[model samples]
Target: MNIDDLVKGIAAGERRALARGITLVESSREDHRAQATALLAALPKEREALRIGLSGTPGVGKSTFIESFGMMLIAQGLRVAVLAIDPSSSRSGGSILGDKTRMDLLSREKDAFIRPSPSQTHLGGVARRTREAVALCEAAGFDVVLIETVGVGQSETVVAEMSDVFLLLLAPAGGDELQGVKRGIMEMADIIVVNKADGDLKPAASRTCADYAGALRLLRKRPQDPDGFPKAMMVSALQESGLSETWGEVQALTDWRRANGFWARARAAQARYWFEQTVKHTLLAQLEAPKAKAALSELSDLVAQGAIDPTKAAQDFVAQLER
Candidate 1:
């Protein structure tokens, strides 16, 4: 479909058009990139959604938690969109993209949309175009957009820049108090949820929650957060318990941010961040041209043979590109 048609369809909340729009945005082809830029520019900007970034270690039941949590939102008559990022195989650059299969029920809901994309070796656990996808979902009228990262540890913080709330899901007894106190992913989380809180794991989940809560206390409070913010909670995604309470906390935190005017400022900062990132990526992409590639190869060989220093070679290569 043409850019105009896609924009109209997205404004009308057509699922097919929204999917196509996301795929267009994620494309790296020059022609598609041009089209994606026009498409995004034409999209309605008035529509907005709550963007939540969810991450966890592998086997932490992120899929289960998302499915249960999404269902709860849908029941409240909220449209939900999930953008799940699957890690790409380093050798093959292929992704299973099996999020739809995993979120069986949510995928089937008329109000729920699930799109899984390959990370394509992008670092920080997110696909390079995930922010665009989130924008499209919001323009398509989703009340909530959930961004699920590849779940790599600690350094997987890029999602926080794009999301209004960052949730860190953990398995019960996964770590002790000291581990929770360590900075990095722990420091980035707005809410640390201990999953599998039902049945046999109840006690362990509670203790884990308390440990993380204490850890949150030790960390310096962010100006954006209200009192008791960045707290820990336990949930049982398997049995769908505590899902409502979790949702309540999410809403409460969001409301607090909105009331204090932090929400708008945060989104503005995110937009500026992505703009800078896009410019950098565009410049890097230019280096993939055949002439540039050849120049880079020659420079690498010269540096390896000690004919030129690596930094000087890089400077000369960049100068060649400028010319």
Candidate 2:
């Protein structure tokens, strides 16, 4: 692939070129990794887009909410990109990649770009290359980039590192359900949205939203937010109700952060974070090399046979690497 031509195309906001760019970043091949690195380095850094991370459990209607939200953004004359992470099977390493299909209307929009990627057993509820993909989208001139996680869990907080606004989507549930939700993920959320707030469920959704609002009040206020922030609201993605209000809140929070100098600081911190993560991941990848794999196999046998404890075996392996 001609990196120069690809860069030109991306600068011109070509969707096809942007898609190929994301594919290049997601590839695991050594050559692809080098090209992806160059592609990222060559892209303009001044171009910026609002990065929103959306997380929720399986039945919480994340896809529906994203579709409605993306359409709304498009109607407002903004080019929107959606990176939906689908859960991959640990054994088969396969994903359904059905987010695009679920968002049929948004997928057909000329101003909307939707990309579904496999989680590949990544614990963060996002693909390993998602950060790079977001960069690609920004370079392609997207006004907003929405990252949809695989599902909400304890480790899903990792998305907070990449997103400017982290939205936690929830469904109408009983009081006990509120207690069951993990506090760690709750603390990471910038906005807690109770979805499906229409029909007979509207009352239940209102009650759930109130419960979450109260819960947010109990948690210590984060310095990065303005007054009355990290709050809860209700939205009906199916009926397209309350979506504009949610978007308004998101913009309000983001604008506040940008004005308070939190935005640039947060982005700088995120860059440093990804740099350290890259070093760790590169070191781990070395273990897959032929010689390293052989040594690891031998050490595994020794540990399994009880000749060496796992910790000692791991230490010896590290020592060999040091040599």
Global CA lDDT of candidate 2, please?
0.92
Model 2 pairs whose backbones collide: none
Candidate 1 Cα misplacement greater than 4 A, ranges:
none
lDDT of 1 by residue, 31-150 (tens): 999999999999899999999999999999999999999999999999999999999999999999998899999999999999999999999999999999999999999999999999
How many clashes (backbone N, Cα, C below 3 Å) per candidate?
Answer: 0, 0
Q: After superposition, which runs of candidate 2 have C-alpha atoms over 4 Å from their true positions?
A: 174-181
- Return the TM-score for each candidate structure: 0.98, 0.97
